[model samples]
Target: MLQLHPEQIAQRLDQLTELSVELGRGAAAGMLHGGDITPLLERIVLVAKDMTGADGGTLYRPSADGRSLEFHISINDSLGLRQGASAGVAIGVPGVALWQDDGAPNLGSVAAYAAHRRVSVNIDDVYQSGDFNFSGMRAFDGHYGYRSTSFLTVPMSDHEGELIGVLQLINAQDRETGLVKAFSATDQRFIEALAAQAAVALTNQLLLRQLEQLLESLVNLINIGIDEKSPYTGRHCQFVPELTMMLADAVHATTHGPMADFQLSENERKQLWLAGLLHDCGKITTPVHVVDKATKLETIYDRIHLVDTRFEVLLRDAEIAALKAQLASPAQADEITLALREQQALLREERDFLRHANIGGEGMSPADQERVRHIAQRRWTGPDGAERDFLDANELENLTIRFGTLTDAERKIINNHISVSIRMLEALPWPKHLQKVPEYAGGHHERMDGKGYPRGLTREQMSVPARLMAIADIFEALTACDRPYKKGKSLSESLRILGHFSLNGHIDPDLFDVFIRSKVYLAFAHKHMQPDQVDAVDEAAIPGYVP
Candidate 1:
């Protein structure tokens, strides 16, 4: 037996102590930031071979059904072999079967034996030992003119005492002569400690991955719930993500522009994409009645019908006046009928005019709005058994709205969605990758000059993603045909408005320029915009464009 003197043994022990410390630190780091199991698995085999002075090694993880031990990693300094996910190479070697076709544990192979028995298998020389099968190894040696010698196989068990995998090292070499030697007790013990750390690290990593997947699924479910509550909003949620990606992809693809230095890793892209999907998630708290408001006169229904009722009262009063004139002077009955007919015709025209006005439009002229006030000045009887003005105070305010359908109060309610959305997202404790989600989602409504809502972050304070979403939000709303209040603007009109916003410092100037140059507008037009809404956009006419 080869033995060391006391002084030599002390030196070896000290080296082993330092090696252990380094290996422990490496294992801990791999556990936390390995990125994938392949790296961690490759790490285990490489480190084990270094400590034991082994010429080659392999790591085997049990197949999903536990029917075979799949070779996850195979590395060898002597054979110049590297195979597995980490190397981006296909594992050419056939996997070792853990169980026979006859449903018996295949304990003939050394790695399988360690896995089946849950113990370590150490051999002085595989060529001499009559323990487990080495026929495959012998064949490998014959083909390569290499020696099949020492073997040490150790089973890796996790904290739950479940077998995670097996680690096998072969052909331990002499420290001085470079000759093959048997693996010693010290070498086997060191490998066993590494196997233990590997097993636990693998388990924790798998658990972390599973947890992240769960959280991602929950985010999707929340979006689905929002869609179910308001389909109009749901379409907006789905479309914004797609459009955001298109714009982001454009910036990424550009090589010689303002955004050339800007790019996103797969994870960063994922983070931005998710933020887009959840930009309006706070709309879940908004009242459905307010969100679906279709017209200036809409509540539970349009109040135009109430005005129709008042018109009927006036017509009834006119018919009564005609009958009274006929009774007072039968000879003048024909004159009274002609006069009443003219008055009745005027009332019908006025009623039709008011009905047309009630259906909200782009712009109400000052003269048209004044005409509505004139109509309101006429008298009618209320349902409360009292005489009142034809149009009530609320009706006057609604009819005379200078722009879109929403009154100031209703607009405030609609705007509160951003505040609510920020609240919902900020409440969650996000993982590192998703930490910017709330910021990105919340900043969609903010402006370049800090004239936005909830927080009103300035351009310098906002991320490119937030500014990009602001443009997306406005364009989507402008071109959306499914909204209750207004006609979808044609592509030209939408671009004109977007240009105005960009010039006014409502959105990022550079991103808007990139958007124009990249034809992101064209791509979105082809995908989502209706053909009618998609019209030719004049480049020169577009506001703020130097081209």
Candidate 2:
């Protein structure tokens, strides 16, 4: 036994009080910094060892199936051993089986027995004890030429009174002689209290992780709804977040540029990721027919089918006229035959032209649009026994759009999605780090010159994340094959277009420069673009980009 003088006992009381304060403060802090669960668990175990002046300690958590106690944290002061993800120094250490194959508690192991019994076990000397097995401890001591004794094992029961894990402290030392001694009654009591605090910290961390995972799953569900709504945009929801992270990582790593100081914390990275995943969530409300428009004459059905029917009507009328002329003047049959041939040829040519024009193209010339108008003016009979113009007003408007597919009305319907998206995002009560998610996701469509929709925020008003997403949106749009608008553009062409946007203030100039200079464009292209679309880019040819 180690006897303590009155002065030494007072000193020990002060140290124990300090340790209690430290444990309480740590538990309170753990709730906020639950993100550091692994590290926090390790710290708690080490702190327990410090409180008892133990030379070695370990902390274990229940395995996934609740069959065993897996080592989460391990430290040996005498052996200078540290292991776990938290400490970044891993060693091969087997887990403890809390229950035997026959469903019996593992009483042969101190840590396992403590966890199985949900109680604290204190032994003044393992070599002198017969109540429990300490054979493994003897083996460890034998190999190291050490006398392992003075064991303290406590079950870390959670608030719900379920044992989550166990903490084991070994080899309490004498204060004056630096020799191993019995763990005191005070040490056992203080350690049990520390174990309680550790349990709270661990529980808080686990709950926080579970909550974060649940949130991510919910975000993914939103994106899944959007993806199901528009097949063309499923890839958009997936790829944009990936590209956003890539560019953000580049920004984080850059130490010698205008964006060198622009770094994202882990929390900021997560926020941006969530924003990217939910960027087009409001598209769920968009009409699928308009979203998946594949042709100029497309609606519920392609109106070109109606147009084809009218051309057939004209062909029938011309054939009837030709037959009448042939029968009326058999002597000049050859002359009538030549005129009929010309009319048939002209009708066939016109019908074929309309069929070709129905497919959406990047641009429609004024002359071509005028030709469509003339075609619309030709007369045809309807099913109602009324003779109407060849094309309806809607049909003509869609055909003469001067660009891909959509008419003025349809374009407005498509453009209003941004407003709805902003409304949908702003409705949520967000936390501080995530308050900007709506802003970041909402600003991808915005222009740098204050010409953007919903809110005409200029370059200075947007965040770096917003600016990064803009480039991602444009580049992905230009290279995505899933869209109904046009074929995916080549990498060089896309970069050239992106460069033009930068010079014209359509996108953030600095971000575009970084996108080019850091080779982020190439990185994205290599991963997302089609093999043929991944063409070599000419850096000098790209306007607004310097060497």
Q: Pick by lDDT: which candidate is best?
A: 1
* Residues 1-547, model 2: lDDT tens digits: 5455667557656765665566556544543454555655776777677666799888888899888888888888888878884668764667788888999888888888888778889898888889877776777788878778788888998788888888888889875687888788777877787777667766766676677678789888887887878878888989988998888888788887688788887778878888898888878888887888888898878888888888888888888988898899898889888988898888789888888778878788899889999988988777898999888898888888888888788888887877887888889877565688888889888999999776888989999998888889888988998787689999998988999999998998777777888899898888878899998888988999998
**What's the alpha carbon RMSD for model 1?**
4.4
TM-score of each: 0.82, 0.90
Clashing pairs in 1: none
Best by TM-score: 2
Q: Which stretches of candidate 2 lie over 4 Å from their true place?
A: 1-36, 85-89, 255-257, 328-336
Encode model 1's per-residue lDDT on 431-498: one tens digit a residue: 78678889888999899988988787899898888878888888888888888777789988898899
Query: Candidate 1's error at 4, in angstroms?
Result: 8.3
Clash number for each model: 0, 0
